[model samples]
Target: MIEGFTSSLAEVNGTRLHYVAGGQGDPVVLLPGWPRTWYQFHKIIPLLAQRYRVIAVDLRGMGDSDSPLPGTTRRPWPAIYTS
Candidate 1:
């Protein structure tokens, strides 16, 4: 057997974000796509736990977090876009 990690909810910028935390290095924010859950990164989490403090989160309207109605486009976008 092995030690376990933890998951919880965090309210950020009005959205209730669900997150899983582990490891012990620089903060690494794992932002998923619009329709995907944080579980998509389950495979990489362990590898990351070896070197980084991994934090995988379910974006607003996805997964364990609260799914609210659509909002204006002025809000934040996923971290993938380089603009």
Candidate 2:
């Protein structure tokens, strides 16, 4: 919940992905490392947003994004995020 930034959810690849976006210009996507959520970039988002359209996403099963069903392991990551 950083100032000037807004969060939203998008349905992609049959899953809902959560993201926080702000600013304008060329796009910049931020993905947190393992065991972390978009909040990991909360401190740097505003700075980056000053010069680019920053999008910090909560990967599936993290933060506000939906979790996959147990034993599910066939979904392709790139397809889910790109499409």
Candidate 3:
């Protein structure tokens, strides 16, 4: 919710993932640890946005992202981050 940051939902691996992006320059992805969400970086997101394009994501089963049920097969998730 920072001034310049924009939040969005993306369909990745058949899951709806939530993320916030802002600023410019090289991309910087922020992945929260277990039981956490992108809000964890609320304080620093704006600061880092000053120098880089910051992207904070809410991983599967966390935050605004859709949680996949157990035993379900999913495409590789890392591919979304790598490219």
Candidate 4:
């Protein structure tokens, strides 16, 4: 409910990821660095949305995205980030 943006949850590799998307055009995915959530791009979303479909996501173990279970291997971390 952030103006023109829409929030959603996606399940990938058994993990649920949270994201906000808006605008229409070529797709643009935004991934925030550690300790930050999708809201970090709030101020710029509107500007980017004008020319492209902006999708800001909350990476795993941060924000509303599900955290990995204790003892889980970190090997998949790279795949998660790239995908």
Top candidate on TM-score is 2
Residues 7-72 of candidate 2: C-alpha lDDT, one tens digit per residue:
899998778999999999999999988678999998888899899999999998999998876655
Please give each candidate's TM-score. Answer: 0.75, 0.90, 0.85, 0.89
Give the Cα-based TM-score of candidate 2 against the true structure.
Answer: 0.90
Q: What residue runs in model 4 are displaced by over 4 Å at the alpha carbon?
A: 81-83
Clashes of 2: 0
lDDT value, residue 13 of candidate 1: 54
Off by over 4 Å in 2: none
Number of clashes in every candidate structure? 0, 0, 0, 0
Quote model 1's TM-score.
Answer: 0.75
lDDT of 4 by residue, 18-81 (tens): 9999999999999998989999999999999999999999988889999986766566686765
The residue-level lDDT of candidate 2 at 59 comes to: 90
For candidate 1, the lDDT comes to: 0.73
Clashing pairs in 4: none
Per-residue CA lDDT of candidate 1, range 5-81, in tens?
58888875566778888888997878877689778888888888888888888876678987664663455554212
Query: Please, what are the lDDT tens digits per residue for candidate 3 over residues 1-83?
Result: 78988989998756789999999999999999989999999999988989999999998889999887566536466754443
Model 3 global lDDT (CA atoms, 0 to 1)? 0.87
Off by over 4 Å in 3: 73-83
Ranking by lDDT: 2, 4, 3, 1
How good is model 4 by TM-score? 0.89
Ten-residue stretch with the least lDDT total in model 1:
74-83
